[model samples]
Target chain A: MTSHPHPAPTEAGALPGSLLIRNLRKEYRAGQPVLKDISLAVEGRGITAIIGPSGTGKSTLIRCINRLVDPTSGEIWFGGSDLARLRGRSLRMARRRIGMVFQEYNLVERLSVIENVLCGRLGYVPAWRAFLRRFPDSDVERAFALLDAVGLGADFATRRADQLSGGQRQRVGIARAVMQDPALVLADEPTSSLDPKTSVEIMELMAALSAGGGTPIVINIHNVDLARRFAQRVIGMSRGEVVFDGPPDALEDRHLTDIYGGEGWLS
Target chain B: MSEAALSGPSRRWVRFTPVERGARALVYVLTAVAVIWSLRTIEIIPEFLYDAPEQTADLFVRMWPFDWAFYPKAVHAALIETLHTATLGTLLALVLAIPFSFLAARNFTRSGPLNWIAQFVFVSSRSVNSLIWALLFVAIFGPGPLAGTLAIAFRSIGFVGKLFGEALEEAQQGPIEALTAAGAPRSMILVKGYWPQVEPAFWSVALLRWDINIRESAVLGLVGAGGIGVALDAALNNLYWDQVGLILAVIFAVVIATEFVTSFIRSRIL
Candidate 1:
């Protein structure tokens, strides 16, 4: 398991809250690696944006954190516990502390806005209560508050998710993620599907929420400008390897060209 | 360029060989000959051409002079009984189908052998017609609405279970993944992720089964299982054509009413 070589670090930083990845390797097929021996540390409460081209295993990397896509071999140490080794009840408990936002919104289309938002608390609540739509009063209040924070008012709660526009649905998605009251939030291309203005707004909202909650966020973004604007630290990936990791001021054109492989799209 | 070069080559028309054309013609001729011969052999002469319109008109006239008082006593009790049978059977089937559907759905149960067993049970239950099931139940349980109800219920389980399983399998994988990641038990995922997605489909299928069961229950009584079918059988046996006409009219009315009610319920749910 420990035979694979660790890839060279693109940058060095002290990541908070102690999420240490040591020699993480994932391969879908035998000897055909999707993720090579990737080692990194995520520390403290701040946004870390992972920027990479498509099919470079950015989404796969984030999903592996939550075990949505199980890693072939890795050690994810968070808060003195190895998340990879946990299973069943213990795994769920760990996941409740981790929130995730998707690019497509992935809201339950048939369920009402409030119900979909309430799903974030599914990890905390009893199964019977969640099944019956009998969410706790505090959770309900918090859900409504989160909705308001995301710019959707109380009236929109009763409307089905399918009835909402893309922006509104994504707002609900973000609200649901926040509803988990997670210690860590992972956003995989959160603004990829949104327009320019909406993307900025969403990024701002996520940055503000993470800041206010003191939660560490790891966001996978394709937009370098948005990432530079929002993220405290930007990690660049190419060919499943991190090529650059630093502050916006420290990043130059050469590094961008190296990461994305061309100067044509940079303009 | 020359006109011939611009126009390109003239394609050869591929025509069928003489033998092939003859064979095609022979097939048509044979089909026509067989159809005509079979029709004649079955004595399918159109007797309507020789029918007396006056006699049909007289029969209709007789049916119209209905014992209006008979409608209140005869239809009311039988209609209620039919409704009861249908409701009971549907409820029972819904109860029995839950576990069976879970077993049958490949998404729910990955075990090939278990899924096959569930499918076998569903197939066996559905393979026998409702009427035959009713007859068998009548023999076992003795003649009553119980036999008819059981028959309808048993058949409905197979129908509803198969449909429910399909609906269950097609539910969104996203939420299920989310729940699993949250460290939720399999049961929790089922309750949270599976139930919400499949509920409307389940209700829609159950209502459809109810509609079908109502009609089946009505006819099951013909085999002594108890309902309007028993009355229909009696009317036909006695050669009371007036009563038969009356019963048919009532059955038609009941069917239409049930259809309307079920449609209304279905619209509300979906």
Candidate 2:
């Protein structure tokens, strides 16, 4: 853990997708900070898991990266721009390079699966084109191919998103993020609502896809074991602060106790 | 100590406080008094009351011999005009209310003054009855289907806009957030996110409003705007009770038919 509160000029420009969060702070209410001065460096490639107890601001931290939840004061350096200060058109253009997945698989329930997957290209395509569902042929093909890669075949493409099972929906969600051709993907509790088996499958699928595309992924996950299994690096958080940052092997039982603050559930 | 406490006395749970119980009793008394006082003030004539059934029977007797001949010349055309007015008015209301609904929807627009203006329009439209709207439009447009259509459209704007706005507000933010995070513009997010979620609700509201407009439009002709009500009004003025009865029957049938059609369509859409 370098703990560099500032992004070194040399490393900042070194990678296309590398993220440098410097002294990030968020206060929903005056004098009450939910995220207090968080700083982290995520490399341009591979999976980085953020594991913490509920309400510890792991989701907030990941959201701040993509400007989903604005940081009160900080600098998020990505794609050679300050993601923190980006506004309006610039912000939207910057967001085109960062994709996101949600725990609920947040697809438009009434929309067809293919369209849901194609939604990732909404930023690149004109509004009227998206409205008319006249996505470019290349994007359509990429969407279908991503669907297949996520294990949803051509048969599932025409079906409504709501018709799919939890695992199937998550697959579509992953396909959508991949369809963005993003340099970075942020997943907020991507497997929190799934069953244990499905959760493991989703994690494996995410790992393989990110590795295949070399798109760096930062996941906010509650499952420590999944993080340890799938992530190259794990950052442990407690009470809105990063308490541990290292390889998964370095995350010891004592560290878990410190992160979650209870020994009863450790066993 | 625990055994003694358990055996001592059972606690009582009262549903309401003494003040609340007294208030409820007072409300009942006030309602009864208001009903009695209103009844006493609007005195019914004893002679008219005694002749009411006889008069009704005589009126029915006069209306009995049906006006089948009048259907082709007047009733049919007026009926068609009424339907056209209702359909057109409903369409116009839908088109106008859609933008207003988006404006009023807190989640969609996020502007306080715009929401207030939209809400004010809805309130003003709803406050004036369709008949009153017909009267106003009749003054400006001078008594025709156009006035009737305008009245129906104006009255329905509030009903459609308020309900559709609520539906837009109720749409889950998750999908919208997902679209926003995907770097989609505001319009794209609306197209992909809000539109899909609100489509069914929009259809349901539109159909319900159209059904109501049919009934309202039928009566607009009484105010000299063109519909079946105008025919009925003419029949009433000329002492043509039979034509009036026929028109009433037609209105009743059309209203019931529209109710069935709207409900069926609503069930399918929902």
Candidate 3:
């Protein structure tokens, strides 16, 4: 497994820590914690894969950063502001800067692919424009470009989302994410629903997008090999806590055992 | 070993108490009595059976003998007015229901008190029948198509709002989550995620309501609210069965035709 090296530091106006989660804790019910005290800083660019066993809080942690599931206690410092305290318009403004891809494509199934891709601009575009399906020219161009980059051609734009295959839908999903011109991209088990070959392709597209656009990516993945293959840094999680955080080369069998527990499954 | 095991169970059965036996007998007796009672109560008596056939046959005979002459006048304007009233009412209802339905949806309105208020408004609007609403409107607006239109529109809001709200609730949570995560405002999320999913169901419901309103509008005219049913009612009162027959025939044909058209439209949409 090989990893992409981190991008060189740039002087452009970039958020210092694309995401800074400090002492994050979440509990769905009292005394039953989904995410324990977690502290991590995601770099400004490149993919950082979060690998964890099933039932671990990998999904919960990613969701918390986006505040899809609000944190019980924590400060998520993005750019210069703490997202946990933000509400209403302020929260939406922060969210607009972040893009998310999901395990399920999550495209509005009845909507055309172009419309689904254009949904990324819903935050920036006026409600009337969204309701009318009248996306601005620039957003359309960017969506088309992103679609082309993801290997979908012009004709697929008018097709209903449900008509597409899994890989095709995920490509649209990625396009929608990038359409946001997001500062940070969060993918939660994006490729888990795809076949191995398609998973690799999806991961490659995500990696390239992360590196090319210099968008910081925090991905929750179940496959260790895929994580090591694409990510610059691997954060191993078990029972809602980070067990190991280092470069993929430094991640060894012991760390895997510790993260997953027991030797029988490792083979 | 097998004989001894079986014998022990048989001996236990023999030890069964008189109370168990009495309970079993009671169950059988009660079931028998209940069955006999129901049969006696439900059995159609000779008098009812003899009375219904003659009445049904007389009605059929009286309705027949053909009403060809009245068809021309009935089809010329009355049918058209019914369709027009229905179309106006349904369209108006659809426009009014959209905002109210969004407010009424529990998922969208998280505040319990607000949801209760919305629900109260929706339930109250729907509680009154269209005919009753038409009567009330006629009292306010006077005898005209306007009252009929308002009545149909008001009644339709209850139905469309409740159904559309439910459809909105059942919309895929995935798109909503994605929109929220992307920081889209509540209004944006509704347009992008919620409306798209519910649009088809909304349209279908509206179309169905339109068809029903057409039928209702026909009857509203009998109450002085403008439609063909007034003429039909007068014809019936004057014992002009031939004209009544003609009006009934026109209504039946119109309804069937509208249903076919609506079904075709719904199929294309789906």
Stretches of model 2 off by over 4 angstroms after superposition: A1-13, B1-6
lDDT of 1 by residue, B77-169 (tens): 776787788899999999998898999989888999989988988898899998899999999999988998899888888899999999998
TM-score of chain A of each: 0.92, 0.95, 0.94
Docking class of 2: high
For B56-160, candidate 2 gives per-residue lDDT tens digits of: 999999888879788898999999999999999999999999999999999999999999999999999999999999999999999999999999999999999
User: What's model 2's lDDT at A68?
Assistant: 88
Residues A78-194, candidate 3: write the lDDT tens digits: 866777777889888988888999999899898899888988998899888887778799989988888899999999999999999999999999999888888999999999999
Expressed as tens digits, the lDDT of each residue in B146-187 for candidate 3 is 898899899888888888888887888998998888778888
Evaluation by lDDT, superior candidate among 2 and 3: 2
What is the lDDT, from 0 to 100, of the residue B181 in candidate 3?
83
- CA lDDT of each prediction against the hidden true structure: 0.83, 0.92, 0.86
TM-score for chain A, prediction 2: 0.95
> How accurate locally is residue A114 in candidate 3, as Cα lDDT from 0 to 100?
89
Best by DockQ: 2
Whose TM-score is greatest here?
A: 2
Q: Pick the candidate with the highest lDDT.
A: 2
**Least well predicted 10-residue stretch by lDDT in candidate 3 chain B:** B7-16
Per-residue lDDT over A42-159 for candidate 2, one digit per residue giving the tens place of the 0 to 100 score: 8988999999899999988988888889999988988877888889999999998999999999999999999999999998998778877889999999998998898989999999
